[model samples]
Target: MTVYATFDSPLGELLLVGEESATAVGGTALVSLSLPGQKGAAEVRDGWRLAPEEFEEITAQLRAYFAGELTCFSIEFARGAGTDFQRRVWRAVEEIPYGRTATYGQIAERVGSAGAGVRAVGTAIGRNPLLVVRPCHRVIGADGALRGYAGGLPSKERLLGLEGALVP
Candidate 1:
């Protein structure tokens, strides 16, 4: 069974879910954006985790990311579902290091396409359920303006701000 842990971040309350492997399946909400049940449902952790590194370190990494001390994550986990295009987009998202952001058009370009592919890229990005754990928040509008954010625009603003990206 997948195990879930809840932690608080400067962004907001976050829920981390994983398998026997501690990599995350997904994380939800950010700084006042978390409404009750706003995030995907997950099993709450009230028992001991069976193996691997301390959960605290996972929590610590998340904390570090939000604090701007961390950029990339080394957690070993899996995302639940997707198509090849979606996976490609997610992988491209992973390639984006911290403190930097990419536009959907640019992501499309990276995936060997063009501005016309921005919608498809945005579609794939919207399918990102992993939140900050996967760094999906780093994707933005081509004009450097905030577009649609699943976790809410305010949280999106916070994440970009934390990463030192100027928001319009």
Candidate 2:
């Protein structure tokens, strides 16, 4: 069964979705994490359980991250969360260290999509389900300009600022 919880964060209310998983922290593997009004945000569908207690570990980790005390996320992801190509793109995104930024073309190269595939890499990054946890905001434009973010550009700027990766 699907389960969800809400977290009031520096950005806004965040929707946290997940499901049971033996290997996940708090026994629930994260499905998605979206900011308020995020594009393609996950909805609290009927029949989904609201179990705040199940997210204790996740919430703590999030708290630490927002407080600038945590650099990496240790949460587990639900199995079969995305297409294979999307997963590959996400894995490449995960390698973008905190406080650093990468260009879409760079990610495309990492995913074996060099040259014309930059757009496809951006598309997959736009669809990243885990938001801050997956660190999609670290992907920027080739000219050092902040580009599209599922959580919107303002939110993306704030996130990068928090990480000290944003230039004046």
63-164, model 1: which lDDT tens digit per residue?
788777887876654544678888889899989877788888889998976867889988888777677777778888888888877677778888888888
Where does candidate 1 stray beyond 4 Å?
A: 22-54
Model 2 over residues 1-168: C-alpha lDDT tens digits? Answer: 789999999999999999978778798999999999999999999999999888999999999999999999999988787789999999999999999999999999999999999999999999999999999999999999989999999999998998899644
TM-score of each: 0.78, 0.98
How many Å off is the CA of 58 in candidate 1?
Answer: 1.5
Q: Score candidate 2 by lDDT.
A: 0.93
- Candidate 2's C-alpha runs over 4 A off are none
lDDT of each: 0.68, 0.93
